[model samples]
Structure formats: C-alpha cells, structure tokens
Target: MNIEFKKNKLSIALSIALLTNLSLMAEEKSPKELDSVTVIGNENSDYKSKEKVKLNRTKMDIEDTAKSIQSFNENFIEDSQLQNIENIITMSSNTVYNGDNHGRTNDISMRGFSGVPILIDGLKVTNKMAHPEVYNFESIEIQKGPDSLQYGESSPGGIVNLVKKKPTKETLGKIELEVSDNSSYTPKLDVAGSLNKEESLYFRLVSVLKYDEGWTNSNTETNKVFIAPSLSYDVNDNHTLTFMAEYTDETTPSSFGTYVNSKGNLVAPIKNTISNPDEEFEKTQKIIGFDLDSTFDTWNSNFRYRYIDYEGDNGNVHMPQSYNEATNIVSRAFASQKQEFEEHALQYTLNKEIDILEFKNKISLGADYNKAYSKLDMFYDPSTPYLINLSHPSYEHLTSASEHSGVMDMSSDKTYVESWGTFLQDSIYLTNNLIFNAGVRYSESKPKNGQRSDALTPSFGLVYHFSDQTSIYTNYSESFTPNSQEDTSGNILDPEEGKGYEIGIKQKLFDDNLNLTAAIFKIEKENIAELDPDDPTLSKYKASGKQESRGFELDINGNITPNWSIVASYGYTDTKNKDNNNLDLKNIPEHTANIFTSYYLTSFGLPNTYIGGGAKYLGSRYADENNKIKFDSEIIYNATVGYKKGRWRANLSVQNLTDEEYVDGALSSNARGTRVYVGTPRTLLATISYSF
Candidate 1:
C-alpha cells in the first residue's frame, strides 16, 4: 500500500478513492486477507494482557486521523497518581497549568490560548475548563494541534479525551478505602463480571465517595459520586457490540487567597480559619453519555450519544485582595456568580482494513452532530467600596487575621448563551506504514445578547513510523470562542479565534514499558475582542484581537526499569501581541518543568514497598498583558514512602517537602494593580488503604 495525501482534493476524488477500494472498505474476510486485517482480530495476539494489547497500533493505523493524538492506559495514571482531569497537565508534556484556582477556576495554554474541547469515549464532552470526574476511565487519548474537520469551531490548541472501561469476559474488580493526613477519606468500589450463562455477554459497575477537610486551616469538606455501567456482547467470534453510560457530580469551594506587595514581592492573605460551615463558595457538575457499536469480519461501525449538564455558583465567602505589601489594602467587596452549560452530540463511524497495490491498507470515515447551550450570571458590588484603613481595626473590611466580613451583590448578576456545530473526517492508510487524515466542520453559535456567526474549518495531518518504537507526525487546527457578558454603558467586545500547527516524534521502548515524545508547536490568536485604548471607540480597534504564541517541548514517561517508573517534561513558551508589540500573555511562563519518579524498594529488599519523590517548577511570569512587572518563579517538591502487602497498603507523603514558597497562579483584571496566590508550603500527608 502506498498512501500519498495531496493538500487539496476534490470530494469527488475521495469518494472515488473509497468506492474503488472494495476489499479495504468491506467486512468480507478471505484466508490471505485474514493475516493483515487491522480491525480487532489478529492484533489481539500482541500481548498476554488486554492493557498491553491495546498499545500495538503502528503509525499507519492513525496517520489519517484529523488531529494529533497520544494515548495512555491505567498504568500511566496509577504511576502518576493523577487526581483528575485537572492533574492531566502534569501527565502530558505539551500541557501547562495556569492556576490551581482551587479547582474552582482553571486556565490552560496550548500553543498559546485557552478554550479547547474535551471528549469522553471518543465523543465531545464540554469546552469549559472544569475538570471532570475520573473514576471509571481505562485510558485517555489527547488529540491536539489541529481539529476543524472532526470537531466544529474549536480552539486550535487541541482536544482532551477520556476512554471509558468496557465489560470483558473476565471477572475483575477492586475495593479500596484510603485516608489521608488532611482528614480526607475516600472509599471506592469497582466490579466487572461476565454473564457466564450468556457466554457472549459481560457487565461492569463502579462507584466512589470522597471527603476532604483540605490543606487550609479553614474546615472544608469535598465530595464526589460516580457510576458507570457497561454491557458488551460478542455477536460472533469476530464481532462484538458494547453499550455504556457514565454519571458524575461534585462540588468544591473557591479559596480565593491572594498574594502581592508594592515593591513587587509576594505576601500571604489574612484569613479566618474558624469554622463557619455556612459561609463558602462552590461548583457542581454532572455528565451522562452512551455509545453503540457493530463489527464484521473486516469492518467496524459505531454510534455515540452524549449529554452533559454543568452548573456552578461562587459567592458569599470574603476573598482577599492582592497580597502586595506596598499596595496593601483591605476593601469591602462582593461578588455573586452562577453558570449553566449543556451539551448534546451524536456521531457515527465506519472503519476497515484491506490489501491493495501489493500492500495492506486501512480506512476510516465518520460524521458528527453537536449542540451546546450556556449562560452565566455575574455581579460584583462591594460593601466597603474603598480599602478600609487597615491600621484601624474598626474600619470596614479591615480586621485582625480573623475578623472581617462585608456584603456582596446578591441580586444583579445573570446571563445566558447557546450554540451548535457539525463535523466530518476521513483517514486512509495509503501504505502499511504511513497514514493520512483530513476533516471539515461547520458551526453556528447564538448568545442571548450577542452576535452570532456560522463558521467552517478544515484540518489535515500525517504520520510516519520507523517501527513500533518510534514515529513522526504533524498536524494543523483552528477554533473560535465568543465573549458574551458586558459592563454598563451599552458596550460589548468581539469573539476570540485561535489557530496553530504542531509537529513531533514519539518513541516507545522496553517492550512498551517506556515512552518518550518531543514536539515543536506554534499557536496564534486574532480578533481577541479587547478594549480600545487609543480611540476608546468601543467597537473598533486594530490591535484589539492580535496575539501569537510559539514554543518547543520535550517529554518522557514510563518505567525506567520494571520497578522504577517516571514522568518528566520541559517547555519554553513565549506569547505576545502581534500588533501592539509591547504586551505579554498573562500567566504563561517562559519556562516550565516537572519531574516525578517512583521505585519499588522491594527490588532490593522488601517485596511490597516503594519510595517516590518529584518536583514542579514554574519560571517568572507576568500578571498582566503589559509585562511591566513580574512574579518570581518557584519550585515545589514532594516525596512519598509506602508499602503494599497482600490486600493492604500504607504510605506517608510530604508535599512542598522543602517548604519552597511558590505561587500556583496570578492575574490582574480591569485594574492596573496585579494579584497573585501562593500555593501550599510544606505539608505532610499519610494514607492507609485496604481491599478485601
């Protein structure tokens, strides 16, 4: 097979290419063809376990994909101890985290912008940055760089996807109960069983409950619930069908602690650690989705339906102002905010493998329909309008490290939005070792009080493999986002749009035990819809929407040896306004790196023991676009010691082990003054777990 992809191709040529290749698009299996069919048959022979078997895909199998993709399994998550989607940034080399926002708020930078899409089990999830629950996932796949053909009107940064666990013929399950030093308790139960009586049917179920008092001296508790059920049936020895559904709900408070000083240094917020169980801020989210599939001797088909409801509210709790000592001020302020977002999507796919031109080839065709609706209500009305004279404890919003409370607007904040899109894509394996992929999309978005636009975006990509251990790939993507809410004075801004290109190479070694990847990427943003400075023309400004970002990356993750595993990354990024030439992208550091590793002490002495440590480093960054000032970069270190014997385990971990003071994030909106938040300092956590 020889796969050569031209940049521009008429629809007629692609149709003809597919119509003329019967053996490669149909499911009819012949003796000689059975040896090379790439669907779900012979490939199953690669490993003793399904986890390993799933990683055997070569470059030719995915070269035609519409986006740049990377896949990881349970071992990857377990080895990294990823908490949720929020922690995924630490797991992927191409990702950078802007703030902890205490999980209440999240800002991401890929290429150079935010607002990328998320997917579950291959279906679009939500574009909002809120982290989704991760209790029932088997693996995760990231499709980045370019994606206009498969998903409509998306940000050029890329896509994040989570693959659900399916029912298998084997009965497997785990029940775990863990307690941490922060007064956090989590109990989880997961079970998968085969319907032996049906021979071809299997089922799986999972549930979890978590509560934490938190690292803050203020008493707080967080909880989550997740349930996923799946059923898979073998229609025959060569075909199988599966059905699955997932649901999750959770809430966490917004601990808006700030940091800042007049001399441009960091400061801690004055807080009340007392127990006020009734005063706090929070967020709640829920998601539901299902998928269907059919397979034949040579081809496989699938249908997916996904629906999600995400809503959150942040109010009440008194948040601190900037932590700057020089600009120290305690003001009476209040904010009441609420958001509601909904998504529904449907998709269909067809894939097959065949021999042609003296070579074996693979093909994929798919179409998708997506609809999204959202609305947010926001209001900020301060009680003590001006910073109270801190020297005077009786002044408004000014008290000791404990006594301070003010009124926040409770009735004036409310807003809403709605949007939708459709997309299609195709992948053709022109040769046994090379792949080509292309896609296109159209979308229409309408907000309650803003302009609406219908957009079309196209994408392309290519992948070349040297062997099962290494591959090289490149891709292009585009996206659009609208800014709806507005201040008084009958004023509004335009929407934001992003575009970018990425190229990289990946290597897998040690019998699939170690993986390494490196890539260079560039992303740009235009029509940013910012405020006019020169003319203050409200709606007209030349440099308002101009911005660009460029960077290079190196990342590696996997077992150094059977008992030693690690994940590490280093990135250099630079973002600026193309028009103004004097502004810097806030929160995006010029340098970032993280290294985490673990080793089983049992390899030398004990059979069920481990020791681990890691560190995360963020370089100095701007808190505003002007780049007039900077926040010192800081490094956070962690260490852990644990042992597992039979069905029981225990461990002690120290976070910020060196007590290295660090700021998780910083920002300045609608003001000349900057604001920042220092992440936790030195803290210790201990955990004990058991399974029956």
Candidate 2:
C-alpha cells in the first residue's frame, strides 16, 4: 500500500509541477509567440536542442518520436564530469551498470535484459563487447525497447549510440587537467578548426592521457592513452565526405575484488590483499571509418564504411570456490587469457520525401553488413593451487605456473560471426498533427560453430500532436537474439524472439525551456537458450525458456527558472521467468530514482558561479536465480561547484559524498564463485579548462 501511495504521489507531484509551469508560460506569451519557442537552449541553459535520428531514418524533433529516447548533450556531460561511459550509464534512467572487476569494461542492462548494442555514429564498431573512450564523443543517445527493425538482432534492453565531434569552420579548442583524490591524474586536449581557405576542409583532434596509483592499499597501478583525429571535406554544395580514426591503450597490473566465502557470504579480505602480484590487464583498440553524405532535390543518401581491431590480454588472480570454514583457509588460482578481434562493416541508407494522394510521405531504405572474427586463448593454473589464510593472508607464495612451463593452452577455440540485414520504413502524415510509422526488417546471422539463423521483424507506431507544446505517442516493436550455442546435431537453436509495446507523452513548457516525459512499456520473450537438461555440456544447448517484463519511467530535464536547472528520473520494473516458476531475474532492481538540480548565483553578486547536487537511489535486488540471496538497497549523493569567467572554466566535483559502500556490479550466482565489484568511495576531482 505504501508503494502504491508513493507512486501515485510522485506522478501527481510531477503532473502538478508541469501544469503550473505551462499555465505560467501561457500567461506570459501569446499563442502565436509560443510557436517560435525552441526546446534547445545555449550552453548556459540546461536543455539541449534535439538532433537525434528518428526510427524512420529522418531527422525530427525528439518530442515527435513514437518511442522513448534520451540524449546526454555535451553541456551536461561536462557539467556532470562524466569521464567514462560507465559514468554516463549510471546517470541514465532505468539502467544498471554491470561493472567488471577491472572497471575498464562496461556492461549495461535495461528492462530486465542485457547485451545492449553499442554504436558509434550509427555504425557498429564491435559486436564482441567493448567500450570506447567517452571523451571522443560529443553526444550519447539512449534508445529504449526493441529496435531490431533498424539495427539487427539485439536483446530487449535497447541500444546506445555515441556521436563523435566533427570539425567546425570556426576555431575552437580546450585544454584541461584534473586531479582526483584517488591518486589519479589526467590531461586532455580538444582542438577543431578549418584547414583551407575555402572553409570546406576541416579537422578535429582529441587526446587524453591518464595515470592512477592504486586506489586500494595494494601495489596496483593503471595507465591509459587515447587519441582521435577526424577530417571533413566538401566536394560540392550537395556532397560531403568525412573520415575518422581513433586509438586507445590501457593497462592495469593489479587485480583486486571481493569474493564469496564458504558460508555463501561476500567478504572483502583486506584493502591490501593482492592475490597475485604479477596480475595484469592490457587492452588496445583501433578504428578507422569514413562517411559519404549526399543530398538531391528529392532524396538523401548516406554511405559509410569502417574497420575495427581490438586485442586484450589478462593474466589475473582468481578466487576458487573451495573454502575451509574451520581453518579459514581459501583456495586461489591463476589464469591468463588473450583475445583478438577484427571487424569490417558497411552501411548505406536512402531516403525520399514526396506527396502521396494529398498526404505527405517519407520513405527510407537501408542495408548493413558486418563480418567479425575473434580468437581466444586461455590457460588456467588450478592444479597446483595456492592456499590463503583468510584471517591473515600472504601472497608471497602465489605465482603463475605457466611462467616456468611456457605453454599456454587454448579454450573456446576461435569464433567467427557475421550478419547482414535490410530494412524499410515509412512515415505517413494523415494531417499536420498526426503521423503514422511502420517498418520491417529481415536479418540473417551465421556463426562458425553453429547453423545460420534468420529473422523477420516488424514495427508500428503513432504520434499525435495535441498542441505545439504537447504530444502523445505509442509503438509496437519486435526483436530477435541469435544464440551462439550449438545443439547436439551441431545446429544452432532458433533465435529468441521478443515483442514490445510502449506508450508515452512528451511536453514542453516555459517557452520550451523545460521538457517532461512519461512512458509505460511491456515486453515478452520466448525461445530463450538454456542448458540441455539431459546432456548439460558447454557445447550443447536448447531453446525452451520464456521471460516477461513490465515497466514505467518518468523523466524531466531543463530550466525551471532562468537561474535554476534540473534533471530528474524515476523507473519501476517487474520481471519474471515463466519457465522457472516465475522466479525474479537476478541483478535487476525494482525501483530506482535520480534527481539533480543546479542554481546560478548571478543574482547574488557572483556573476559566473554555480552550485549543484544530486541523489541516486537503487531499490533492493535479488542476487540469485532462486531469489535466495539478496542485496540491500543504497542511496548515493554527489555535489558540484564551478565558475566560468572569460574563456576559462574551473570545477570541483565529489562523488559518493556520504562514503557509502555498495556493489556496483556482480557475476551470476550460479557460477562457481560470485565475484563482486565494490563501488568507489567518496572521491573528489578538480579540473580547469581554457577555450580559444
């Protein structure tokens, strides 16, 4: 009963606030004048103008789209000091970060599912799961629900796209240095300008270098280097070309985390605990891409090609499941795994605008092809394991046996996966205020170890504009996920199929300075891949499971007043596995909320100063499939202060202000041993930037 009351109260409070703001705007501006209002504001304003692509392959206002989409603009990214992709995911609505032990790789979950695809500038960089440097992108787009019609196969969670910063005609540059309480130091530079007198040749360059001493008491350290360069050339008024390249290298020589003890309890042995002194993680990534954009009198076209390479080596310490409760002695192991990946992809789209039988119409056709190859070599030293006294531990005896043997075995062999897809979408306008959307796609995927899988998915949506400031939208979409596991006959199982439905409302108030969104959605998935009951082996699988999820979300962003800005969101999700006796899914919270607000002190004689704070809450969650183990809820706080004068800006930000200890990510409970990643404690960062 209390939960219901709180939900109602939140909905009522937000509704009242939005209505009050709308009424006040109505009194200040005439209807004709309101028509000229824009939802996007300047850098100083909290709101950003909409520049996201719609499902129909058309550039339209986000408020007019039929599905839920969110944008984190450059201004907000800087204000929040979002230095990494994981930081951005933490701030997104209805999202959860599945942190890896190393804190370098990111896996995000939404709507009770995982494997959310990540794209760069509408192109797939890596399907093998990788994270790009956050500093290379200008904006990040979050699309919710089943998007298989546009992309290919995907989980029900949704997708994230990063848009890179392009070259500009005017000279713009910024250099910044940051110092963090966690013994971390970073230096970054961004410069973009034209290269020729014609103003048609432009270039942009971005670089970052970071080094951090051990955050824990262990003898661990981390270092990273990143560089990106891009160029743009205009052949004519209707034709343009762009080229982009990026490289990243990161290394961490220490492995530190908590482990599950014999009593099935998570234990942080010690701050100075180092299972293996020689443990290290190293990664390198490179990407090169080009874009060809053309515009004709009645049609528009875009063609893109990209090649990406990624390699990683991890020689890390491990905690074994064997623990002696009486003597407090736990077993430890070691592993060395190396992974290599290469991908080549091409994507093209053609769109035409026309008038059909007095109704305006926009039609688009697109095709994408991707080929990926990956190899994995893993060696584990579990035979001669090391024993550790949990009460008083010493790692002097722990060493890799392979260092002396010089033989590295291989596991999982080599994997090669490829996919191709074609799609068609159309948007028909019944009237200037009402729009209908429909799309269909056919995709095929083949893995080296499994048979081919094909899927045909379709989507439909509608958007109705009640007024210039308000709109209501609804969509029905389908999705499919290909299984990499092979059956006893060496044939892949049928792809898991999912269907989703969503309805939402978007509104603009206070002369388009504020934006509000509310949405409700549900998804059902079938034919989920599961272990073969009779012959449960790593090489065999079956598809006979089902799951369902229902959720609702509310979000608000923009300026409440000329001096005050706010961003807030609330999400509620309910999920169950039907075949598993309706057991709750693991690692998904039931309720989550985040609120951030900032105010300028210009009126108080501090012309260029600002202060802001935020709060994040995650509800209790189940840790295992049977729901036997659970993790308690937690609330975190953050604060920021900044000043901008002339071309100089400086900011100080603190995270986890209350020093809360929480688990940011974890592995499945069904595993041999559950690995838990502890969240960062209270930390401070100070940065200063100068722009020209």
Candidate 3:
C-alpha cells in the first residue's frame, strides 16, 4: 500500500504539471459551446447557480445567505457513482462517517459532533438510525453550523437534505444497470411523464434491485429492494400538489466490526474473513408523504406531511477483552433483539416580499411538529453460554447466544417522544449591496414520563457586496436540544445549548465560472448533561458541562476554463471538552481535503471523451475518548475515464486505486470494547445508461 501511494503521489504531481501548461490550449477552443459542458446541472453556470431555499425558507442567492453550504447535483452524483451517504462524505471536506455503518443509520459527524439528522424534501421523515438509498433523489444539500432556526434541535455540526425527483410534464426517463468487482449486481428503472392529455397531471416511478456479496472474513451479505412512486397535480396557475410513497426491504449481517489489536491494525486472519458470519438481521421500512405549494399576489406558502415506520430484528456479537498476541484469540459474547419504530411529522412555511421605505425585504414564517414511538425486546438467559475464538469459529457455539426461556428476557419498555418548533426570519436589503438578516425560533419537547421543556433561539447575519462577483459576510446562530435524562426523583435535566459565530468572504471570477469561499467559525456549548464523576455503575447527572470548537474552511467549485471543471475543499478544526481534558471526540479528522477535476477532450478528435481523477487526505484521528489509541493518516487516489454521445453514456470508475488499507468507522468504548471497520480496498464499477 505504501509503494502504491508513493506512485500515485508522483502521478498527481505530473498531472498538475500538465494542467499548468493547458492555458494556451484552452484559449484556442470555441467558447460558444462552453455553456453546454454541464458539471453540477443545467440550471446555472459552474460558479454560480440558483438560490437555495433551505437556508432561510426563502429563495436567496448563496452570497446573500451569510452561511456555509455545499450542494451536489445529478451530474456529480452520476459521474462519481455515489450510491450511499458514506460514499458522499469520502469526497466531502470536513465530514466523517461517524456511524458504525452497521447497514442501518448514515450517522455523519462534522466539527466533532455526531448524529446530524437527514431530511427529505424539507421534512424530517426518519430518525438518525435509517440509511435510505440515494438513487431516488435529484440532489443533496448540506447546511453547515447551527441551523436550528430552519431545522429544529440537531447537533451543532449541520444538517443534510435529500431533494426528491419530481414528476415532469415532459416525457423523460432512463434505465441503468451497474456491476462492481465485489460480486454486486444492480438493476434500476426510472420513468416520468405526463399522466393526462392536458398535461395538468404527471407521475414518476422508480424501482431498483440489488444483491451484494461482501468481503470474505467480514461475513456480510446485503440484499435490498426499493420502489418509489409519485404523482403531481396542477390545480391552477398558482397552486400545485404532489404525493410520494416509498417502500424498502433488506436483509444484512449484524455485527459491531472487528477488534483493533494492540498494534493498531484490524485483527483479520485474512482480508474478507468474518469472525461471526452466521449472525444476521432483517429490516423493513416505509414512507408516505405529500406537499402543497401555493403562490399568491402578496405571498407564497408550502406545506408538507410525512409518516415513516420501521421494524427489524438483529443478533450481535461483542468481544470484551483485548486480543492476546500469543494466542491470537479474543473472548466474545452474543445477543439478539427485536425493535420497532414509527414517526409522523408536518411542516409549513410562508414567504412574503415587500418594500419598506426603499429597502427590499423578504420575510419567512414556518412551523414543524413531530411525534415518535419506539419499542424493543431482547432474548436472554443466564444459563446460556456465549463465547467464540477468533482463529477457530463455529455457528453451533454462536447459537447459544440467542437463548430464551419461553418469555422475552428484557425490554426497553414503550417510549414516546414529541417535539415542535415555530420560527420567523427576515432578510432586509438595507441598500443595493448591503443585506441584514434576523431570525428566531421557539422549540419544545415532551417525554412520556418526564417534564416538558421549551426555549427560544435566535440568529443574526450581515452581508456586504463589493461588486457583482465579491462579498463579505458574518453571522451568529444558537441551538438547543432537550435532554431525556432524569435524576432519582424523575425530573428532566436542562436542555443542551450551543452558540456559534462565523465570518467569511466569497468571490467569483472569469465570468462567474470560478467560485471561492473561505470562512472561520467558533462554537461553544453549555448545559451539557454528563454522568457523575464519582459513580460508574449507579449513574448521576450534572448539567454543568462545557465544550468549545473552532475551525476554518475553504471551498472552491465551478470551471477554471471552458473545458475544465473542478470541485475542491480544505478544512481545519480544533475541538475540546473544557471540563474534562482526558476525553476527546472520536472519528473526527482535524485536517481533511478533497479535489476532483475533469476536462473535456475536444482537441484529440474525441469531442465526447473525458478523463479525471482526484485525491482525498485525512489526518490521524483517535478511536477512544481518551485519545490513547490513534489511527494513522492516509491518502487515497481515484481515477475515471468515460465517453458520452447523443443520449447514451458509459463510464468505468476506479476507487482507492492504490488498494490503501484504512479505517473509516470506529465504535467508541462501552461495555463491549473498541472495534473498527476496515475500509474498502481498490474496487471497480462499470455503468452504462441511456436517457430519452
């Protein structure tokens, strides 16, 4: 792996040298057709695009929003073959896959915090533990920092929004088949067109089937089936309604991953080997939603409602003690549980534009309400023996881990949690080049057996444009989440609170074909609940906890020349637990970066041919809270070559071309122990598609 990395590094240097000499060649190409070279999408140029409504619940350009945001469109998704959220984060700056990747949740972490929620079409549809397929969505949007004013009660890191594909009046669709080197097969179908002759109604249907036979020792197999159907109706010139439904069923192996030996390497007898290949889990998930949009002379409004349900049963194997180097063995135990979850949510927004004494103003008001319930039952027996050997394993011994004596051994009991929030924001243009923004939200949460808590959060921002292509901005925001913890008397503790501040400058050049943004930010939190220092078994709570984080991020996107397109970013973050110097957050790389670029080869008599590659670098990160064990830094390189002509396209992509061994996820210490999931090796994916 080390030799491969060195070779790739040399290649990267040579590629840069070649790019530096392409200026003369770029100047000779026809500029007229440059507009047809789409990178993100067809809506706007590579440097500047349409306003994002998720920022302030109103249409506002990126320069006027005074916050950090990143977006990936259809073109990028297809070119990169980003099948899941984990794949997206690998190329995303300052982001880490915090989740264990247990085939359940797409848990992401940024700026040292974890479990940021994922929203679908502006509505919170599922909890943090669900990982939905991305093929059904048209684009992905990420809003960094505290966004509680727009989306309520989330980690200060940020939020992700998946924009679903809507029904189009024009008849258009595509069918695609994909195959990978990992013994995976996938077939997909998508079609959208007018449902009525008048073109007032439209519908779209998408379905996909996949089967993946994973690595050898990992003992993991995943099979999935997904279907989504949607319909849209145009009631009048100013009103529209859309309905959408999705269903998914999957079966996968359940395990916490492999133990990291004292040498800091994953303990695998050989690649693809699994210590517990027989343990498995099955799950089913469903979602139904609708949206209503209306535009009036004075204002525009939108309403969304969704319901989600999930059921699954999983068997887990836990290794408590560290692996003995001499014996090459680790002691482990097994358990099984059945769980269910259901949630319903509704959201509404109203936007108005008005002129106040020569100042143009945009105001938005919104509300969100949601209720969730979950239940779990576990099978256990004191008499059952549970143990396994790493070098030598057997399913017969593992069966003893799920023993039950006629009745369920334990349960989490039935629990219900409800939350709601209301917010109002105003963006006032004090002058043609100056803008001021202010917003506030009132949020509350109620537990089935604890006291309800509510609070008010606020935010403010200012932007000054120097010209059509340059601007400077600053902002401050606050966030809060009610704690579910209770003392001996059964009273809820205070809610966690966060305050953040940011300042940045943005610029565009070469007719808005190149975009650059740089920002520095700081966040502080209070009222963080934690366990009593004196007691480890009999737990006690304290609200007097503190944490602080500071960081700087730089992002560049769009085209450098008529035929050259690029997306790149760099991030530096420092985080600390103020009250406890011994603890640090896990899986957060202090320095991370990504850069990918593609150039159309119109000069070599191959007008539709293109080749591109990029590198991702991650700094060393700790696996345990105490920072005793650390994973070394790594750099992975990838390349792609493809051709597009008329309506047909074919591409071959190689990820981790160097076959670098790395760790992408680490489970923090608990009763079980610390274990890490090995990163994927060099893999190849080939895709072909035709669109009408």
lDDT of 1 by residue, 236-338 (tens): 7766667766665554546554545543465443342211223344555555555566667777777777776767665444444423245455454445566
Please give, for residues 1-692, the per-residue lDDT of candidate 2 as tens digits: 66434533443454345345534644676777545433212325464535565233555568657888777767677777755676676566777776654533467778877767777787765543345667777777778888798788887878877788877766666667777997777767787777888889988999877666655655546667788998999999999999998888877654445554433455653353536554667788888989999999989999999888888877555535455555666677666677888999999999898999999888889999998988887777666567777556677544554453643465776678889999998889989999998999999998776678999999999999999899999999999988777677777788999899999999887788888888999989988888877775665788888999899998777788887887778889899999889987877888888887778798898868988888888877776778776777889898999987765788999988998877655565553555556666788989887654
Q: Model 3, which residues run further than 4 Å from truth?
A: 1-56, 126-129, 218-220, 269-275, 315-327, 381-385, 389-408, 534-537, 582-584, 670-672
TM-scores for all candidates: the values are 0.78, 0.89, 0.88
lDDT of 1 at 492: 46
Highest lDDT scorer: 2
lDDT tens per residue, model 3, 1-692:
66434533443454344334333433454866334333212321232234364534665778798887777666666666656766665455577775555556777877667767778887775553455677887777777777689878877877777787788787665666678998876667677778788889999988777667765554556777788999999999899999999898776666456666554566654353333566667788888989899999879999989888888778654323344545555554445677888999999999999998878899999999999888887755434343455556544435544354543367799898899999999999999899999999999888787689987999899999999999999999988878877655556788888888999998987778777888899988788888756555557677888877789988777778766777788988887878778266677888989887776787687777777777888788888766767888888888888777765677888888898988776865443455677666888988876554
> Considering summed lDDT, which 10 consecutive residues are worst modelled in model 2?
36-45
Ordered by lDDT, highest first, the candidates read 2, 3, 1
lDDT accuracy of residue 173 in candidate 3: 54
- Residue-pair clashes per prediction, in order, are 22, 0, 7
What's model 1's lDDT at 621? 76
Superior by TM-score: candidate 2 or candidate 3: 2
Residue 509 error for model 3, in Å?
3.0
